[model samples]
Target: MGTSLQHHGAETSPPPVCRFAPSTTGPAHLGTLAAALLCWLDARSRGARLLLRLEDLDPDRCRPEHARSLLDDFTWLGLDWDEILAQRTLAAQHEAALDHLEARGALYPCDATREALRAIGRRAPDGGFAYDNRSRERPLPPGGWRACHEPIRVALPAGTFRPFDEGGLDLAQEPALAFGDPVVRRRDGAIAYQLAVVVDDAASGVTRIVRGRDIAPSTATQAALQTLLGLPAPVYRHHLLLLEARGGKLAKTHLAPRGAALGLSAPRLCGQLAACVGLLPAPEDCTPTDLLRTFDWQRVTTIDRVVRWQDGQLDATPADP
Candidate 1:
């Protein structure tokens, strides 16, 4: 066994490939920019390919202007990626992947209403909602929620349900013990996030996922989907979120000064962004070239930090590293 393991370790490994997948629902703020910078530095230091993916699947919320703004912001930051992909452009591909999962009996149709799900969640004693798989065998009436656990089987097509912990915190036996079967496709035909993200990542050949810590739960669902689809899971690195002065995280909707308000050129903004993530010195004046030379990934903090916007000035303070 040791010899076999040694042989496997001796095999050549592929080059590291990382991606920054950001939703184009709003302007790219400091939080998103910090994640992008870290991914860029990590990939560049390892001589790996850095790809940018626009997650614009939420058509109702995503806007073309936001996408353009994101591109502009990244360009201003002096970050370059090898390839860029939009989720809307790959709808057919994602649909095809869904069809494959459906064919394998891995997914089922769900007709649960938002209110019904919320009611179920409220009824749970532990405050954690569990789907009753049996609800899939028997159709629920209008305004009903389908159960993903058994003893109350709901109507579902013939398929093999994969075991998942939903929370992704434990790998225990009795697949249904932790999480009940989650819905992959809604009755209205809208794909769930778990299904969409997994399909997209696999199809795009994303090997590493870099993002904020808030979406860690979604990552677990993606991991389960990878196993069901027989695809390799990507490495995940959750960076600290940038917070606002009100003790809330900085969001695109926050009324911060724009490019003109900051009175900063492209080179200046690039330098400031580098300093925000502790990549360069915190001097008042530094050129973009200086930042490029000093860019280092080791200095990035693992704990959430604050990017306070006070009186038109942006102050970045590192939290627990």
Candidate 2:
């Protein structure tokens, strides 16, 4: 890995490399479409290289069919990418990263179970149960940290860290207190999202990250990881999310309709997603290429949007014509 990038107050001059990383746990929904479109627009507008990365980290929920279907959805919606990658294919690199952290004495094996986490009863900013970093107090295995089969967590640096985001979002906080020391490796030996993403982005030389605002809360934690790993931090621009009216964000758990299941043509679905983020005046049938000329970060909405999936159609007030 390269040394930590110097922040000299000027953006990196290389043609930006951006990625649309989507988890393949389920079919692509409106929220997924919206995030994909925003990422495509941002990269295409700047004539940057865009990558489509399948985040199929969880073996339990992620399936091959879902990954194939997501690729089809992107193709149908006229979203093109310069390169593609699967997170699962890089397990060796993730393990190597863990090896690096362990060598630095920055990692510890954690045996805390989910039931024990619930017992602590602390809530994180993102509303999930916050880990109390109990593993920090435990001794490493007799052989070493890596000799254990338990989950591995990073010893996150202390003090508040305020990372810079191009979207003007406030990402200031102590990562350990905000989300606790994130698990870098699960007991099952799967590389956790936080560490995997930082390691992958650095290895791929990704310069910018454009995605939904819902991931904003995790930025500080990931930023801390980047610092510890001696990797370059990407410029971040979190776009608005397509949320369900009553249940919060549209997600696989909500059974939100996939782009194929939406019963709309490709251009029509692209238009609806574009309009939701202020890329278009209204939801008019169009391709991702059609909106590139007018795409501007300033035009994207910062507010979360409410959308409804009813009667075989998407009803988002902002996109309503």
Candidate 1 residue lDDT tens string, 1-321: 355433445766687778888888899877777777777777776677778888887757788899889998888777788999887777776667655665564554454555766666633222356555545444433433233331111122223333332223232222232345556655534555666777777777877776666665445445556676777877766666777766677788863334775676655555566667666665255544455565654675555666765554567776544
Off by more than 4 A, model 2 = 1-12, 143-145, 253-261, 310-313, 318-321
True-structure lDDT of candidate 1: 0.62
Q: What lDDT score is found at residue 119 in candidate 1?
A: 64
Deviating ranges (above 4 Å) for candidate 1: 1-13, 122-134, 138-183, 186-188, 255-257, 281-296, 318-321
- TM-score for each prediction? 0.74, 0.90
Model 1 Cα shift for residue 249 (angstroms): 3.0
For each of the candidates, the C-alpha root-mean-square deviation to the true structure, in angstroms, is 7.6, 5.5
Alpha-carbon error at 280 in model 2, in Å? 1.7
